[model samples]
Target: MLVKSLNVLILIVLLPFFVKAQTCGITNIALGKPVTVSAEQQYHVGADAVDGNVSSGWFAPGDNNYIYVDLGQSYNICKIKIIWQTDGRGKDYKAQVSTDATNWTDIFSRTNNNASTDSFTVNGTGRYVRILIATRVNNWASIEMSELEIYNSLAGNTRPSVSMTLPANNASFFSGANIKLTALANDPNGSISKVEFYQGLEKLGEVLQAPYTFTWANVQAGTYSLRAKAYDNQNADSLSLPVTIIVNPSTRWSLLGNQGTNPDSVFLGTTDNKRLVFKTNNAERMTILSDGFVGIGTSTKPNAETKFAVNGAVYAKKLKITQTGWADYVFNDDYRLPALSEVEKYIKSHKHLPGVPTTAEVEKNGTDVGEIQALLLKKIEELTLYIIEQNKKIEEQQRKISELENKEVNRN
Candidate 1:
């Protein structure tokens, strides 16, 4: 009976110390939270520290490495635990707490620590918790940690939910266009504080009230990932799934009038060596080649020798042809007109007039309208000359006849 009473008294005396040595059943508040680090290796990211997995870890070379986690809201921090990797451990380190993540207050610190794991009680209240490794054990240059557990002495709070509502995923836009970003945010147990819009990691703008919206103006051409972050009244934040968008170059002419344009710089053609096609009713009507050849109503390539080709007939009210020379030179005094007999002989041999194309030739190679018209005029002037000569001869014969008749009458 005496030994039992003594054992019970000793147990009562050490119960308070045992309770103080360990965490008071508080839940870890840093699990799966957003983690930031000063530097990290390629595969060992900062998120590994608060991911609740002790196999994978964050690795940063060089001493004075630091990492932090956002608890999503303010908490009465009660304890902290750090599990180090087998080969990497901190020689001197400290724990800090911050409400805004800018200013920090030291809660616990140790020097010349050689333990593989460290657990300690702390009295602080903050939404952000940080661990700074001042030096590595064994004078090493790298420090690695597997897990960092932070315990809070308060109940868990619901995080705000957010989602992007405008500019659907994989959307496209022209460069220099204003992109309107809209988000729908809700908090189950509290009111929303603000919603911030981001393009990748760049914050575009923020909205503090309902109907969260922001306009990002004059965005340049590129592929971008956009998201929204919503914060509740308790400062707990949640990120929306990213929306990807593409911004294409805008070097196009609009139907409306344009200003500040340079005629020499502006063009309506392809930059590459490809044909520019014009379509009407989903049918190709015309095409302009890279070499400046144009085809109308023709799918086949335009003839290389011609500048413009039309597959069908063309009608115009008036057509003009500019020629270097005309048939007026046919009336020159030095001109030697072909004899009628010689022209007849040539026509009989060739089955066509001199200096004119044959029927077969005209069918194979189209005629030049100006050249053919000039040849026709030259033939007309030559015929007129021939008629004049014949008339002169007839007049002479009639004069002679009249003179002879007069002489005969006188003799009678």
Candidate 2:
């Protein structure tokens, strides 16, 4: 009876260890490890199965295809998980382990697998783990797996650490700007193989060597979540904390200096329906309305009827005025030339010259310089015509007087 009781006590003492040996932790030892395959399709190489990304995987087309992973060294593998791609699962397969890779020993086998994902508690100790497929699900000729995770009951590889160094969190930039992304990555027990930069789920770029950097150019305007993922030489990877950034419209100009700017694309204006104001000495110097009217030396909105409004005088070396029509039409034959008597009557009654703006009109609505110049030219042309007519009359009178003199001399 004492022997029986001692045996029961001994079994209880080893119960916890046995339970621990049957289950494996979450760490996947097969990740980032070197892999080999009998045959692989494009973009579905054997390395994809251990890339730590379940979305990407390996695919081989034909019967009796197999893929194997090298864990770098042997481990006490306790769990094997296979996530099969839809419609591309292996119906008959075997999970095998090997020390020399040439001689393999099957730890688990399955026939007519209907599950898309399968996990098995395996008792194996080897440097390599392989999966051999004899037939595909639904009698398909291709076999594919999204992930093949091998968990070691013993200690395994450590994942690399990564952090973004450039473009600090919450940083802002202009659209179409070239942003340099940098990352600092290191492996605890191995060496870094590559660092990939991602904006959300989309990968921007990657660098294989040290001083990892990528230039993301011509990024559109939007809010983005950025991160860096570092993969070690063993294929184990870890992501840095996400960094959020803001990309504003490229129309914004810096008060400092700007480089690599296209003059045609640069603008100083408002994006919305608001007026843009310029100031000097804490006072408004210029204002531009949303409708394109400009004002100088004033704060109030410019006159809508006029394209430009100024409260102060303007100084320019030269000024130009464009007119749709000129007073040269005054010389047209169809134009009636008013008599001088009619012009005198108009000036006397209206207190201004004919076709000229009155003082009150000029003060209230302002004068158009082009219109005034045209009117003055028209008056000068009319005065020239009057002087020519008077000269002709005087010549006619002189001719008559000379004729009379000639007649008198002849008669005498």
Candidate 3:
């Protein structure tokens, strides 16, 4: 009998209130509306915008209060959405969270304004939460809020970390054997990331870059390739393609020139280079690499060490520089202006320049005599023929000298 009576009494109270107030355990926290507020309880932050206590006449004429909650433990927080309780529709709340309450980190904070979010992630672990009323969007009034929640997040997998881009790529080794590898691979699923080189088949010494390269001196002469694979915290690998490279066991880039008059910058121009800028190497070689004479420096001075490509192979020689940057001023002086003298002889023979009057010298001097234009055309032809003939004759003479010497030795 008593059980039946209690049941009936409980039903009467709950039923009438539901029909009257349309709320559960309803509390009159503000105005006629019912609010459920308890930091201990969990609820999804819903549509209630900064609905802090600002509108309830509870906030002093110019008062602001901050509210926040702590998740208690560190979590990989990717996203968070907040619901406000301010009567002006939550238009005056600034929200923030942190591992330490004293130090505040912004999740989303606005003063009398609305906030939006698609997604974002915090790097590490943290705790603490809060919302403060910075200003009144509707009125400079009170701010009050109720209800809070802590989101449970799915953690991200750590990417296989590279301790180093691994050696200066320019670093060389004599052999490819026992290449060291080192890396830090950890996963939520426990050990997913891996370190690899020469595709995936050749298992490296270790799994990472730390020990990736030990003593390249042991590697034999030839070319090789390298690469690394990163696994998500999930242990899935990204073992990549072979990044090609050359293993030059034999040293090639010699200390061509350095210091003193030879500022290493001289041997630089190539199709790969554009300008002549000075650069210094570890060997104290001040070097310049460029493409053409378009660079801002003087023309190249050739010598035995002055290597140049001829038909794709390097050619070096010791030769007398017939014409040089200072050729106009110096070529005719003490130096054997063999080339220039030849040119002068030809000009005298042709006796005229192209496109000029027949009596150009007289014409240029006083009246029309010869065309200088025609004379100049004659000048180039003479100069070219002279240089070609001279070089050929010299080469032929050298060969004959060598042959004669050999014959003399045989006779003796």
Off by over 4 Å in 2: 1-178, 181-253, 257-275, 300-304
Comparing 2 and 3 on TM-score, the stronger one: 2
Best by TM-score: 2
Total clashes for model 3: 75
RMSD of each: 21.0, 14.4, 26.8
For all predicted structures, in order, the TM-scores are 0.38, 0.41, 0.22
Q: Write the per-residue lDDT of candidate 3 for residues 140-247, one digit (tens) a residue.
A: 343433333334344333344433254434455533334443333334433543454442355444343334443332455555665555555344465544445445
* lDDT of model 1, residue 21: 39
| lDDT (Cα, tens digit) per residue for candidate 2, span 1-412 | 9999999999999886665333355679999999999999998999999998889999999679999999999988889999999899999999999999999999999998999999989989999999999999887768888999998874356789999999999999887788889999999866898999999999998999999999998777789999999998667799999999898767656777555444567766668989889998998889888888888886565255787888988889999989967988878989899998999999889998888898898888788898888889999999988898889999999999999999999999
Question: Which candidate, 1 or 3, has the higher TM-score?
Answer: 1
Question: What local lDDT score does residue 122 receive in model 2, on the 0 to 100 scale?
Answer: 91
**lDDT scores for all predictions?**
0.87, 0.87, 0.43
- Per-candidate count of clashing residue pairs (backbone under 3 Å): 0, 2, 75
Compared with the true structure, model 2 gives a TM-score of 0.41
The model with the greater TM-score, 1 or 2, is 2
Worst 10 residues of 1 by lDDT: 18-27
Over 189-291, each residue of candidate 1 has an lDDT whose tens digit, in order, gives 6789999999989999999999999999977778999999999876779999999999876665566643333446555677899899999999999988888
